[model samples]
Target: MATFEEQLKALESVVERLERGDLPLEEALKLFEQGVGLSDGCKKELEAAEGRVQVLLQNRNGTRRVEDLDLEA
Candidate 1:
């Protein structure tokens, strides 16, 4: 499996290619689909990292307290 950074880089490359506007319709569509998948994967990874950060913050006082992170504030 590609690391998150690799996937992100690949997504960027895909966007650059698409923006060039020179690919055949079929190839462009394929790249677009791949980009969407990469974007979704990156989002999920980021959310997981955020959750881990929240947990660490809550444990700063040396007590292991797990709580749901409220991001709506």
Candidate 2:
């Protein structure tokens, strides 16, 4: 399985190719499908990481809590 970074990089490359409009219809469709899968995978990984962070930030009383992450930075 590809790492999250690898998947994201592939998705970016797919987008760049699609944007260039040089690929045939069939090839473009295939790349689009792959891009969709890559996007979903990236999202799932990010959510899992966020969950881990939330768990790590839990109070010592054993209660889980989540604080908003400043992803803009």
User: 39 in model 2: Cα distance from truth in Å?
Assistant: 0.6
Residues 1-73, model 1: lDDT tens digits: 8889999999999999999999999999999999999999999999899778766877657766666668998
Question: Cα deviation in Å at residue 70, candidate 2?
Answer: 3.9
Count of clashing residue pairs in every prediction: 0, 0
- Global lDDT of each candidate: 0.91, 0.96
What is the per-residue lDDT of model 2 for residues 1-73, given as tens digits with 9 covering 90 to 100? 8999999999999999999999999999999999999999999999999989999999999998889888899
